[model samples]
Target: MAGFGWATHSAHKHSANRHHLRTKARMDAGFRQMNGNLERKGSLTSSYLEEPLNKTGVVSCIFSLKQEVGALVKALRLFEEKGINLTHIESRPSRNNKEEYEFFISVDQLSSKALDEVVDGLRTQISGQVHELSRNKQKDTVPWFPNDIQDLDRFANQILSYGSELDADHPGFTDPVYRARRKEFADIAYNYRHAQVIPRVEYTAEEKYCGYREDNIPQLEDISHYLQTCTGFRLRPVAGLLSSRDFLAGLAFRVFHSTQYIRHSSKPMYTPEPDICHELLGHVPLFADPSFAQFSQEIGLASLGAPDEFIEKLATVYWFTVEFGLCKEGNEVKAYGAGLLSSFGELQYCLTDKPKLLPFEPEKTCQQKYPITEFQPVYYVAESFEDAKEKVRKFASIIPRPFSVRYNAYTQRIEVLDNTQQLKNLADSISGEISILCTALRKME
Candidate 1:
């Protein structure tokens, strides 16, 4: 994953793990803020210190629904008429959900002032509502069409997820099967693999203090007791694209991110800063389910852009809705964020009186306010995964084929058929010419 370059707002610790923060609206800054300039830490952690972002991109704006929706609708209509291509749409709640909401929108190309004017014109502020501020803002242009064959090549390159239990004996090693699988997949990336987090083991040599005082990676059996008794949420990060938006797009398509790292035995609720363990073990299982995976990909493609402010705001939406989203699951508040996967804190926090849980509303979520230092004060509850997808669809209604699995599958198959048909024609033509030559040669003979 490429590191996100963030422009910092202040030099302060946003979270316990320096990795869990962000700065400013769009500019990702350095690990340590200094001098008027928010130094580029050259890493995602130092940059988006307090601000949560999708993948590693900077997020600048969580636009107010009242302030930007009109503009957004206007922009979408204009895009339709002018053949503009839009990519992403998401919403997050304002930290204070009493009035406004935040909306995050992105397209292949950045939006311009003219476009913003159209969007702003369409924006309608509610009575006594404040428009959200913009930060690290960027407007991208519609992406040029990709070379189909090149894109095909990119798609054809497959990375399969594979791993095994740690060997334990290797000290910093995984199981022998895990070792073997890792070796097999060492060269390939952009893969979807299935791995479990073994809590009773050491993750890396850097942290040699194994919780169990044992010499092994955690296993399913070892953690079964904990899982049976597990409560709350666990956060796992699926790394998004850095530098190349397409890499992030690809992840948005289908590939889920994960790691082989396991947590120490000491912490039953182990949360690594950012690792395959947290990402894969905690998150990919959701991807395995078609509903979650489709929702993820659909939402991913539905929400692509470059403005840092927009990215930051979208991250919050993803965190609150997809990552840490709660839903009415059989008379209970269930989790969706990987962060809540195994964390006791999440289970309690999400259900506690502190959070203002609202029915998932695109407009409200977009205007919602949140802070990096505190546990979320509000979480938008979706009716279902479909409700989440609907939120994306409703936002990007003007954009056609916003993550239609049937369509993606159909197109994917069509491309295959098209390639196959071309080869078949070549083969037949070659054979026909060969036969003609043979006939001519025979006559001469």
Candidate 2:
């Protein structure tokens, strides 16, 4: 599905209230002294010093201080002396040592050299061990990936809520009643649990103007149960649009993160983002079909550890296939994509010759671009859901991950077949299942 808005939102920011007692001259002297010492040690490189101040990114580091009365203050003073901005800070008792306290600090706008200096200072002066927390593409630094279905809870607050704080161009931006209604929906999603039944929405008549039946706003749990039975796909409420990585990761576990809020009542047929109408009326039916479900999961699985460029490609493929796709039914082309199905006007326009229609090939579809603020000018037509699934499976084989992963439903975990022992375990498990099937067949014979 197209994202609400493709803006990156960082939940962490520098607090304005944080104060430093060190003067500018003192901090500058400290910075120069630290740089000179590091240079003498061959640790601080000249290239790092040439980088612009604005080029810095957020970096988190953890260190533990001795139980001395002023140990925490002394460690913090190291940052103040170097003029580094501490965006966030937290403290907890060290698990390994009761007398020590572990401190986690997120530093904002610090260059690589500056961070290294801070780490060195912390280790040499106040703390013996200092480690930098990282989220990068390296094997050792790759961000955490969800292994089980319940792991999705961590991403609940990780999304950008376009509905809660409406953009100026959004239809409900100035409507007090509409904003309040949206907040009500946002609260439901915020408090939702993994396995709990979804609360039924009593959508107003205006909210039902999207051409769905008056009583068609079924509870998410009902749709989730139906999808589970048909294709093992289930639904979970989301505050708003998740990052492409998080959204596709959910699909890997056969879970769909759906928005609980509906579009502004003033513009029922047109919405700037995905709402309950788009999710249920447009997307739910296809998810119930086994072939399409498999097709969807193929895209999701390929996204694991994928590069940013490839993620954009995968998202585009999702946009063309799952969101605004069309398929042949007998001799007529029918609307199957959620975007087209949800919007009454777009639904009618896409089936007509108003938009360009092309065969749904993953290679071409991934490269095709579409506008988000307006109706899609191009749509991909699939021969059938089964055909789409087979093509996607072939396409997924080429994704550049060094290891392959499979979901173990029995254990509710993703098993990475990167080691010999893991492969052997998987092989033995499969062999036992095959043996059981053989016994049943022999008994029947």
Candidate 3:
């Protein structure tokens, strides 16, 4: 695409918000419904094309075409002949001409010279005036982890803006405020539809998870029981405080911390750490799926008796896969990672033009550094849960460990392979307790 010259904008002065309102109102008039907001293009604002593209090496350009039939085919044929790869395609009413429409196209791996050539080719071959209107360059950025207390306020505000609020049906606690907070968390958790990890289950009394606590929020039992029926994992409740290291060790399944430690009482949506919201909403649902449960366990199992370096790698894998991973759901991409699943702002941000999406590769994901203070600049996309599980297993197999582990459902404890006499005795002591066994083994280490 040519420089910024081709971009079109409203001649009248309009603020960014005004432009957005006008554009959104107009765009919605035609399409059935939009999953995401319309990305502004043209001279009125910063052109997306000007932004730096990331490793995905994808660039998008908008061109005008007549509403006449075969016009789109001719335009596509031009790219096919030039061997240009088109990643996405959509159309909008031309700002200059109402009768005609502008086709927005995204292409991969095409440099400035090559893109210019394609634009020139389209202009010469097509009957309509094909102009490269706007382009967006996807830039690579460091992963941002929110570590500040204030960030919670910003996150909560954004989540509320998405119309996610507490409901009466949400989980309740003895503390009225805590009960309301749990309700808000329930609303937040069920805000997004997650079909990939949460499958329907026919629960039996034997299949029900027996870990619900009185302080634990409601709806958790339903979700946890559903998960237990499917993934062989339950949503276990943890009382009071526990360090990050101890939290995962004491439970083979995911654990939800009580609401007493919840951050931001005024805005319960803001969780400084993985409180009830993060655990029950973010982690529990995923654990309900067998494949994801296995993947999670592999990471958990690999952490045992592993070097710090290996542990870090495993954590990175968990971060990408379990916390903020995305997957292809039919034609559109969907969020499955708990981090994205819980926060509306982050979830919507992932689906927006921002953030670099990389194909999930264990080595690359493990090596990639992440930030803890802000919205992630990048996320890994898996083809499916099965694909994610396979890649995770492959990565887990290479982690340096003295012993392998297998989870026995009948005993409900992890069987350590080739354990010493002392280890064997400890395992026998906690015969049916996975978390206690892991905790004992951790203390021994």
Candidate 4:
């Protein structure tokens, strides 16, 4: 929900307001001309113009630069000479070569002919395997994450088939309700014990992980149990119809996909808002992993009393990592983020040779922009769970908050480290409520 500041790569665009205005004027005129052509020559229009131009007004280019020191400078010079305004440029470790880097660049849009010429030039001067992702624009529509349990069940058979096709193991096979749902999907739940995409747990975390998955279609009670058993986080359900909370008491799963809110009937995969599917499928899976739970709680804890600016940064980090993050498993990149996991279209598209994959760096990850309406144009890939947690810790520490937090798994309380007795006492009061709620929640098991 935070607005991210992107550093422009073009020196001209950074300082020259005149140049920026000129570019805008040219783009507007081009759009107008194209629109007029469509209206005047409706029957005789070219098939090429029939394809909608990218209204995002940006083009992403991924290319490898020669290892030479001057390679980047030469590439920049080419863009400058062509009057191509670049919004962003960053380099990441190439998948194949350690010595070289894959440069991801975003530039202002140009006409099709001009864009084609730029791609040709980059391929000739830069690496031969330059990839320009599909620039085709989708018809604008309201985006949502599926939330309804009943609605999700409508695709149970389809999901089961897809899971079997991928040889995926369904979580929560032990519960009768889960087994019943699995039966509807031809017993896809009992196909395997667990998913290979998740990290392997040692003997210590194994018991708690299994306990978290006791119920396949978890209720608020089940989720509360999972949170306490696995992560020591609490689940606080909302009371009223209209609510202002993004997350309840800094950590609860705020239900956004209920009957009260708007729902998408025609587009099964698309949700106009975050649904229960996004919470259960997208988020809860990672909670089963201990280290990931700690990382997530740290973000939640940091958000408790932080300033709006720092909270925004925390939100950005959460968005990129917890919501849309990918991690490397052996030689493969797998999605663990709820946003990617819940959306079938994006789940497959992300792993394909489509979106740009960059190594997980907290600084860069938080700064990158994402598209919610279409397939993500870029994703940050983590080396491992430990790597992600360490990076998150480093980033969290830099947040300019006045207090520190510590969670007691034994008492199910969050303790605040602060100078003010008033604030400390306030935190203690909340911790007491959490302790009581957690005790009752655990009893549901």
Candidate 5:
């Protein structure tokens, strides 16, 4: 709620390696037990939060969403039939509670049998839902049309198109007034390697978002400066991630590449598009964390290689976890999911009872669709950080993992999509360099 004053795991300078020293000592004793690590607020509690515990075999799935009762019930049955255990759930109102939305959900503590069946079954069920679904990640292993490489290139071209369209007036962005603001825009994207956009509005100057955002600051005219001033982010690799964009045209400077965004005190749910206030405070800390930093860099790099569908799916994954995911330790749930951590409302709701919790399975998560407007009806939880990291790591691979597919298409289309141009170009590019790379990479076998 305030500026640069909150404590963070990034500031966790106690030498986590000592954790291993203690772990080895425990191992020499006899049995190795690890209580999941948890550090929650007022009401949250976990055995691990109080002490260290070990797990012989535990699987955690990560997820989030927004929808109604019937939709959730259908999702529930799919997990139920597979013997999957539902562990945690929380919900928030839609953007405006826009659509009679349900709660956000989470599930954890699953068995191998539950893993195999639930994954297989939910993969089938999630796609079947009338909504779009996204799991943390699971590749087809068979080599789909695209990989992370493709997503990188696809967005490159898009940014290029957007960038080229920018008038001399707007160097980094293409909007009218900023048309004259282009040079100022490109400098930040290039210097800080923080080239992202957010729509800038004159009247909402003090509001959280004006569309394109970066570093979570409202009117983030310069991303590089924001990184330096806020969290001391130098963007060595983050800078590299920017140049990888091969798209010829310049991307609109309006794209709000952020570390912070504003939060509405009166609101009750988290919005995926961050305001300057939220981004700077919530995201920058994680970026400063070594594991999280490297992981995000790899993800961005991997995105350069992924396909369109994969990229879109990845966005959902990011939304659910890095942006708005939650985790459970012992019986208490804490906010590890960025969306929850950054959001005041979801910060509370994700740990509360408005939504249903489900065991996280890549297959099922990929098949489930969620609304961005309000609180989620379901959340996928992991017993530990490994549950969260391993899945994301797998997504960067070249092999195909399972993907979500639907048997029926929803007739109610609130959104209009013109797949003609973007898809065609994207499809072509995927089949072009990405397809060849996947094929060659797989040939190593």
Candidate 6:
């Protein structure tokens, strides 16, 4: 809603309706082309104009076209003529020109002369402008942002599986038996689907490294259900480490991406990275507390579309608070951070005078640097979870983003509040809920 400008109701309604019409027309044409191809080929596989070439790499091209019937199909026909194999295709309404749509296609890489010919043909023939997106530009582009919960499947292979490529200094780097067991856990996580019952793991004696008794090791499904009931937080299995942006985005949807593997037995009480021990003993319990869950989600919401520098700052804030934070328990400081709770050595060491303890301040805490593989030299202590949440909420207000987003529970989708219609729809839903509450109160009286 940040960039929206005030406009007359009639003008706003007209614009919204026009936009809807254009979207519907584009979809209709796409469906018609698909159906025609299906009818001709009699199957989806045979519908391709050319078989994929034995190319070593892929190339992405983007083009824009004025709104016209059969325009998209005509462009596809050009690719067929050039014997170019399209691997993927997507289209979106152009932001710069409302009268046109931008099309993105990934095709098998071609020689410079052939690629230039294809581009020239499109420019002179169907599409007015066509350009190949450079690979470096693709990497620098905005990271893929998920709009739906199921889109998380895209990150399944985002990291190495089972720590198979662990550093030489890692405790499990040379332990084949430990690495084999990790692969088993990784397999389970890889096949997991959204909304499916979470698979349970029976931890071996050596795997219970988080100081929890064997009987106290709750099943992942049970913890997921408890968190869902108490604070709308649930868990999904992750392969391994995620980029800070991807991990924080899961919080926006009240989802936590947890690892299934246990740490190496050699270092039962310590781990270089998060494993099931850290997830269960340190993170799961705090998520059941509503105040802490809200605080966690606030950090996540602030990361969405934030600039790279701000993302680094937010990751630092998370490192200090969620990973290694402390809280005042009346007169004593208690460990609340997952890193402190999961590591026996750090848990006791943090409470001692050896480490510097400072009051939690988002402004300063985000700037403090700490060690990753060793005990934290500094810890930020908050008075209460609620206090931390409020401080973080204020801190998030200054993050630079063009629009605000809200998670719509009913649809399970993130609604970008960038238009008048979206605001009106949210207001109507709230009013209806308030009316229901008032009626119930009156009846009780």
lDDT of each: 0.40, 0.65, 0.49, 0.46, 0.37, 0.63
Listed per candidate, the RMSD to the true structure in angstroms reads 19.1, 13.3, 24.8, 23.7, 22.9, 14.6
Evaluated against the true structure, the overall lDDT of model 2 is 0.65
Residues 1-445 of candidate 1 have per-residue lDDT tens digits of 1111111111221233222223442123321122112123321111012222233332222234334346446435654654545455565553223244455444433443344443443344222222221223223222211112123122222221112223243322533443544443332323322233422323455333433236644443333333223321122112221222332333343433333343333333342232344444445457555667667656555434323444454444555665567877878778876655534455566788887889887655756766544456788888888778878666544332211211133122111111233356446766998999999999999
- Worst ten in a row by lDDT for model 2: 13-22
Give the local distance difference test score of model 5. Answer: 0.37
**Candidate 4 lDDT (Cα, whole model)?**
0.46
Q: lDDT per residue, candidate 5, 336-397, as tens digits? A: 65555655665666677888877655445655676434556788775555566677666546
Ranking by lDDT: 2, 6, 3, 4, 1, 5
For each of the candidates, give the backbone clash count: 85, 0, 16, 7, 121, 0
Against the true structure, whose lDDT is highest? 2
The segments of candidate 5 whose C-alpha lies over 4 angstroms from its true place after superposition are 1-256, 259-273, 395-398, 401-445
lDDT of 3 by residue, 1-445 (tens): 0000000111111112111111222311211111012243222111112222234565656667768888888888877777777887877775445557777776775554467667776677774544323234112111111112111111121111111232343222234765444445444433322122322223223212222233434454466567667866654332222222222332332222222123333334443334444565566667766777777666655554444455456656766777788999899899988777767777778888799999999889988876555677899999988887777777767865434555455544444453243356556657758877788999999
Off by over 4 Å in 1: 1-140, 143-248, 262-272, 304-313, 398-407, 410-445
lDDT of 6 by residue, 1-445 (tens): 0000001111111112111111223312312232222123222211011111223366555677778998888877877777878887877775335567777777655532355566676778874445223232232122234566665554444542223456665678898877777877777777888889988888777666544564646677888898899999998887665556666767878888887776677665545556666687778888898888889888887876565567667777887788778998899889888766666666778899998999999989878865433456888999999899899888888876545667776666666554455677789989999999999999999
TM-score of 4: 0.43
C-alpha TM-scores of all predictions: 0.44, 0.66, 0.44, 0.43, 0.37, 0.66
Model 2 regions lying over 4 Å from their true place: 1-136, 139-141, 204-211, 329-332, 429-445
lDDT of 6: 0.63
